[model samples]
Target: MGSAREALLDAAYEAIVAGDWTGARMADLAARAGVSRQTLYNEFGNRDQLVAALVLREAERFRALTGQAAREAPGDVGDATAAAVTAALTAALDNPLIKATLTDDTSGLLPYLTTRSAAIMDVFREDSIAIFTERWPEPAEHPEVRAEVGWISETAFRLVISHLIVATEPVETTSRHIAEVVRRLMRDLTTT
Candidate 1:
């Protein structure tokens, strides 16, 4: 049953990544997962919920990857924090699902990505904050450090999304700028 659900989610995600979100009908998703439409509906409730679930799943994956990067990066807390932030942002922008969400303006995916919802921003914030706390352990005990980590993480995501969706700059340049911004933010946080 879990495998069936995961299969459905994977199908839906592939549809979205392929710029076929509009074509990702419930019947097609069910067929792709080798389940009936009734089963898909029973499992996911509706298309919006499915989309939210897919995005949330991807966000969690991104958080995990970022946490791993933080753990592996050899540096002080400040450098590790910056490296994690950069890695996460770069990975997100490079992800086919995320790129489709942010770049395909013809689709509603971008709006969905930024929309405020119980399953979207709220879940992302909670997960990311927890990951940041774990990654930057030095800041976990300090209110100031905690606040700075939260601010930097959120700001970095926002900047990256904006750059990808609205700005005309090349991706490499934007990524570099974001990395620098994160590094400076972390340096300041460590010093103050």
Candidate 2:
């Protein structure tokens, strides 16, 4: 049963990446998964639930990658944090799933991205903080440091997303600006 569920999810994810989500129906998803529509509902409840699951799954993957990058980043805490941000933001934007979600007008995924959802925001923050704590492990034990890092991470991520969706400038340039801000923030925080 679990295997079947996983298979369904894998197929659904592939369909999403392939741009099928734009006009994808439950029947299409089930057929692609080699499962019954009933099975899909049993596993994922409904289309909205399925979409939410996909978003959360991608978020987790991004978090893991960011955590690894944070651990491996070079230089001081500031440089390391900036590197992690670059890695995580680049990965998120480059991800096929996210690209589809953000760009596929037919998928209705933009609403999820644009709307304020506490559940989604919690996932984002938790995942971001996980990577951040790994980079600044000591900060994890300090409330003030944790709060500061959280603020920085959220701000940096928002800037990256804004650039991706709204800015005319290239991502690399926007990324550099974000990194510089993070570097400055880290320097100030660490110095004082």
Candidate 2 per-residue lDDT over residues 124-191, each given as its tens digit: 67656666566556666667766787787777666655665565665556656777887676556655
Clashes of 2: 0
Q: Write the per-residue lDDT of candidate 1 for residues 54-131, one digit (tens) a residue.
A: 877886787677667766767554444555656766686678987787767765767655654334445446555665
Q: How many residue pairs clash in each candidate at the backbone level?
A: 0, 0
Poorly placed runs, candidate 2 (over 4 Å): 92-94, 116-121, 130-145, 186-192
| Residue 50 accuracy (lDDT) in model 2 | 80
Minimum summed lDDT over a 10-residue window in model 2 is located at: 112-121
**Which residue pairs does candidate 2 place in steric collision?**
none
- RMSD (Cα, Å) for all candidates, in order, is 3.6, 3.2
